[model samples]
Target: MEQNLQYFLIPFLNWEMMLLIWVGVFAGIWVGAIPGLSVTMAASLLISFTFSWDINSALALICGVFVGGVYGGSITAILLNIPGAPAAIATGIEGYPLAQRGEAGKAIGLCTTVSVFASFVGIIVLAVAAPVIANFSLKFAPRDFFLLAVMGILLIGSIGGGDPVKGITAGAIGILISMVGMDPSTGEMRYTFGNIYLMAGISFVTAMIGLFGVSEALTQFRQAGLKSPKQNLDRIIPSWATFVKYLPLSIRSSLLGVFIGALPGTGGDVAALLAYDQAKRSVRNPSRPFGTGAYEGIVAPETANKGAIGGAFIPMLTLGIPGDAVTAIIIGALYIHGLKPGPMLMIETPHLFWMIVSCLSISSIALLVLGLISVKPFAKIIEIPKEIIMPVVIILSVIGTYAIQNSVVDIFYMIGFGIIGYFMRLYGYATGPMVLGLILGPMLDANYRRTMQGAEDQFLPFLQGFVTSPISLFLTLAIVFLVFSQTAVYRRWRGIQ
Candidate 1:
């Protein structure tokens, strides 16, 4: 215990390590706020220059970026209708409405506070229960993963807004679009149509930038002359009472995030979406109607994504597996530093594990300070005239899309998606369901196929797998409950509004 304590204090004692963490957090905020400039890219770039630097310094910077980047994604989601990351899509559903009503400051403030708290929750779990959680996460099979995807698909009703038919249609289209590449198992062409670009599959980030960023700009052009809302920056931070009021929901969502983050091939994006859907179903008396500006909507997703930061580290440190994209890059960094990142990692060098906990702890504190300080400035962006801001948004959207692969074709695809999104909005069809479908479609396809292969192509055995395994049975039941909870009978029984 004393040795671990000493290792944890190393970062606190070293000024250079401390400074780099602060700087990384500051840079990460801006990078994450830009569409397509992901935390994974930032961490990967750092690895190039920091190859010869001390492992401790490199890790400090990466940890800071991980925490700050996740929080930064919510900034644009609230102020503009664009989500800087996929995890923030649920935030924009309610946050943009709050921004339009001049409550951007309050919304962002609440987000910052809950996020910091959740980061600590994740850190605590990582420190105390990492081995146990890592073992449990490995228990999930392909069939269980497929069920998880199905649960996510069922959320179309929650995020789809008022028109269920339009939402389902848009979601179906997104799934069809996701099927454009070659099959993972057979290597057979799908919807490529002999196009070289289509064979590699569409990058979801490019599609997201077009669907949310560019589409938002085009939609704003319809109300070009209208005055932007005057933001209320008076009460930026939430009171103790307000925080206490949301304590229960925060705890529930953050824990959920941690567990989901610990799962391989899943990350904060999935955690945030699931948390938002759970909050929507469970919270009976929200601050406002869900789609208009519910505070619960903001709290659930922000906390879950932040908690995922810690959860992601659990499997990475204990096992050799990378929890998410950023952690995958971190694994490469470990290899470069002459350190193996497997079951023997802790036994070989325990200092690395404790130092990471320390780094994430400091990063969370930095986020609280920086996030609150920037809330006023970020809210001011919403007050800018549409004529000036919309054009800039469109320009950024194009640049962000091209940056993904340096392809002109992606830019064209983005603009096309933007136009489609605009028309969908015009026709009262929500774009959220489509984006959700695009994100989960591949997961559904790949995992289902894996499960089928495992059953030797036998229909009876494939169907029996769900009931035969404990993990699969639990997930299957959860999916059933999720569908049943959406019905009028359940809603009435529970007195949910």
Candidate 2:
């Protein structure tokens, strides 16, 4: 216990480590607030530059980036309706509406406060229950992952806005677009159509920038004369009573994030969406309806994604598996530093686990201070004249798209999607479902294919797996309940009206 305490104190006591963490968090927030700059990309870049740095320093910086980047995504989502990362897409649903209603400052203040709380929740779980969660995570099968993806897809109904049919149409189109690359297992070209650019596959990040960032700018152009919403900067932070009122929900969503993040191949994005859906179903008499500036909607997803930051480390530290893409990069860093990651990792380097926990804890503190300070500036961006802001948004979207793999073609694709998104909005189609489909389509396809292959392409045996395995059975039943909950009868029975 003494040794563990010493390990945990290393980051807190070392000034260099502390500074690096703060710097990393500061940089990560900017990177993650940009449309195409992702936490994965930032971590990978850090790995390249920090190749010669001490392992402890390198890990501290990366951990800071990991925590801050996830939180940063919500900044753009609330201010501009463009999520810096997919994890913040659900946040944009409620947050953008709040921005339109001139409550951007208050919404972001609440988001920052709850995000810090959730980060602590995740870290506590990582400290206390990591081994158990790691063991349980290994029980998931391909079919179970497929089921999880399906559950994510079903969220179209919740975030679809007013028209269910249009939402499903947009989602289906996104799934088709996601299929335009080579099949992972078979190496067969899907919808590539002999074009070289399409052969490599469309990046969801590029699509997201175009759909949310560029499209939003174009939509603003249509309402050229309307003044932007006047932000309410006073009373930015919620009172203790307000925070306490949402405490139960914050805890629930944060736990859900940890659990989902621990699942290999899933991450904060899925957790946020799931949490948003759960809040939609369970939070009776919300301040306002979801998709229209409800505080409950903002609270659910922001907390869940922040909680995922801790959850993501659980599988990576305790087992060899990465909980998400950022952790996957950290695993590479571990190998580069001549350390093998797996069950024996903790046994061999006991200090490593504790140091990570300590570093993440510090990162959360940095986020709270920095996040609160920046809320006013971020909210002010929403109030800028559309003539000035819209052009800048377009330019940023282009830069963000091109930064991903340095491809000019992606910029063109983003612009095209922007045009398409503008028209879709004009016709009353929400873009959230489409982006969700893009995010989850590959997961569903790849997992379903792998599961089918495991069953030897036999339909009956494939079906039996859902009932045979305990984990699979539970997921299957949950999916059933989710589907049932969408029905009118179920909604009425639950007093959802």
Candidate 2 structure, TM-score to reference: 0.98
lDDT of 2 by residue, 1-497 (tens): 99999999999999999999999998888899999999999999999999999999999999889888998999999998999999999999999889988899999999999999999999999999999999999989899999999999999998887799999999999998999889888999998889999988999889888889988888877776998989999989999999998999999999999999999889999999999999999888888977789999999999999999899999999998999999999999999999999999999998999999999999999999988999998899988888998888889888889989999999999999998988999998988888888989999999999999999999999999999999899989998999899899998988885
With a 3 Å backbone cut-off (N, CA, C), the pairs that clash in candidate 2 are none
- Consecutive 10-residue window with the lowest summed lDDT within model 2: 215-224
Question: What are the runs in model 2 whose C-alpha is more than 4 Å off?
Answer: none
Note the residue pairs that clash in candidate 1. none
How many collisions between residues are there in candidate 1? 0
TM agreement with the true structure for every prediction = 0.99, 0.98
lDDT of candidate 1 over 142-210, digit per residue (tens): 999999999888888988878888899989888888888888879999999999999988888888888
